[model samples]
Each structure stands twice: as structure tokens, then as C-alpha cells.
Target: MKDEEIIELYFKRNERAIEETDVKYGNYLESIANNILNDDLDVEECLNDTYLKTWDKIPPTRPKVFKAFLAKIARELAFDKYRASRSKKRGNGTMHEILDELEECIPASNGVEQSILGQELENIIADYVRSLPEREAFIFLSRYFYADDITAISKKYGISKNNVSVTLSRLRAKLRTRLVKEGYLAS
Candidate 1:
């Protein structure tokens, strides 16, 4: 269903809005939750929560891009779940491991995870992402943001595995340098 149709359903207070949304964006929303939560159960909970939050917010707030709107909610819920459950500190998954590696290069600031600094971090990261070459940025986000496997990203982008690895390494070095120059790192 088109996003405008979905918004119309929400405005009409039809419960099928959630159903249609899940049908369209379930995998996208699930992947967002999975990136932060690690476990399937936690991810599922966030997926359901995304539906509920979308239902609640639509009357007062109808977003222009449904996918991005849903993704933001899913990401926020997953991050909250991760912090409250402290799964990140445990390093129980590849997402945690990868993020830890990046964190070592550019640590988060203040109580930034729960505040305006989060948006600041987003701006910095987005700028860095946009600065990368097309293939490098595509695979980099596929791995880091979407948590896609290297082979899938390579296949989707029509690149070789070695190219993916090389691009990732170069992107990491470039991001680290940008972070350092932006005073987001010293290490």
C-alpha cells in the first residue's frame, strides 16, 4: 500500500492500518530493532511497539515518509531496550561488537545517548556518510546501519567480497579521521 493510503487508514482509525504497515515495512522495522537488540524476542517486542507507537502518534503527527518515521521509532525503541537491558555492555552480538569497534575510535559524549547530543551525533555521522564515495558509502551503511551481511551487500551492490572489505576499511579510516578532526575523538 502507498504511504498516503496508510495515512488515510490511520486517520480513519482503522486497525488495519497496522496490518498494512507491517505488511509493507515489517522487515525494515524488524532490522532496525535487530541492530540494537541482538535477540529475536527483544526485536519482536520492538516491532510490535513500533506499530503501537505509530498508532498512538498518528492523530497528532502524520509523518511524510512512513518508512523513515517507522524506522526512527524502531531505532529509538531498540536503543532504549538495549540500554535498559544493558545488552550492549555484554557484547552478546555482532552489532554490539562492530559498534564497540567504532566506539573505540570515536567515543560518545556526555549523557549524549539520551539527549540532544544524539541528534548532534546523527548530524556528524550523516555528514560523514554523505562524504563517502558511492559504493563505499552504500556498503558501509549496509553493514553498519542496516546490519546487512557482507555478501548480501556485495551482491546487492554488484561488488566483490574483497571490494566490500577494502571499502569498509577505507571508510572506517576516513570516519575515524573526521571524528578526530571534529573533536569527537582523540584516540
Candidate 2:
């Protein structure tokens, strides 16, 4: 079913909205969860949580892109689960590594002022990503947004692992420069 039709189902408070959403976006949501959680059981739980979230949010929130909305919910849930699990066992994973890489570029969230600044920084980064070349943007989002593994990204792009690393390093440097120029980061 199309996104509009599925959204209409939600608006009407029809239970079938969940089923239609699962049919259309289950894998996409699962992939996002899998990237963060890395455990089958955890991924499944996150996906179910995403459906419930979508159901609750749809009545008042009509998203222009349903897939992105679902994916965002799934991603945030997966991150929450990942953080909880890490507090118990700090095992390094793709999500951790990617976040660590971004830690330097993104500003620290101190207080309300920094919170607003963080949102602006996020917008700037999003715009920068959108302005990138197709291949660069794909690789950047895959590694950062989805937290895909370096080896997996290289394999998917049919490129060497070193090349991927170089590309990412350059992109991060460019981002840092842009942030500094925009006064988000101090020189």
C-alpha cells in the first residue's frame, strides 16, 4: 500500500494500519535497528516499539515521508537500547565507533543554549550531507546515520576499506571546518 493510504488508515484508527506499515517498511526499520542493536531479539523488539510509536503519533502527526518517520523512530529506539546495553557491557561496535568519530565534530550539549546550538549544528550537518556528491553522501549516511560497519560499507560500495576510511576522514575534516566557520566550533 502507498504511504498516503497507510496514513489514512492510521487517521481512521484502523488496526490494519499496523499491518500495512509492517508490509511496507518492516525491513527498512529492521535494518536500522539491526545496525544499532546487532542482536536479533533486540532488533525485533525495537521494530515492534516503532510500530506502536507510529500508531500513537500518526493521528496528530501526518508525516510527509512515512518511511523516514518510521526509520527515525526505529533508530532512536535502537540507540536507546544500545545505550542501556552498553551501560551493562561496554563492548565497542559500529555504533560506538561512529558516535565517537562524530563526538569531536559535534558540540557538547551543556545547557539550554547549547541545546539550541546543537539543533542548529544538526541542521547545518544535514544540509552539508544533502549537498555532497551522491557516492559521498551515501557512504557518509551509511556509516554515520545507519552506523554500518566499515568493512560492510566498503563491500557494499565495491571499494577498498582504506578508501572508505580516507573518504570518511576527509568528510569529517570538511564538516569540522564548516562548523568552525559557522561558529559552532572554535578554531
Using lDDT as the measure, which candidate wins?
2
- The CA lDDT at 181 in model 1 is 88
Which tens-of-lDDT digit does each residue in 1-187 have in candidate 1?
Answer: 8999998899899999999999999988887788667789999999998899999999879898889889888888887788778744665665665666566555665664536666676799899889888867778778887766667778999989888777877788888888788876675
Query: Candidate 1: misplaced stretches above 4 Å?
Result: 35-38, 87-91, 112-114, 158-162
Tens-digit lDDT string for candidate 2 (1-187): 8999999999999999999999988988889999998899999999999999999999999999898898889988999999899999997778888889988887788789998777677799999999899999999999988888999999999999999999999999999999999988898
Please give the lDDT score at residue 72 for candidate 1: 84
Score each candidate by Cα lDDT: 0.81, 0.91
Candidate 1: lDDT of 175?
84
| True-structure Cα RMSD, model 2 | 1.3
Cα-based lDDT at residue 71, candidate 2: 81
- Angstrom error of the Cα, residue 86, model 1: value is 3.8
Candidate 1: the clashing residue pairs are none
What is candidate 1's local distance difference test score?
Answer: 0.81
Query: Which one is best on TM-score?
Result: 2
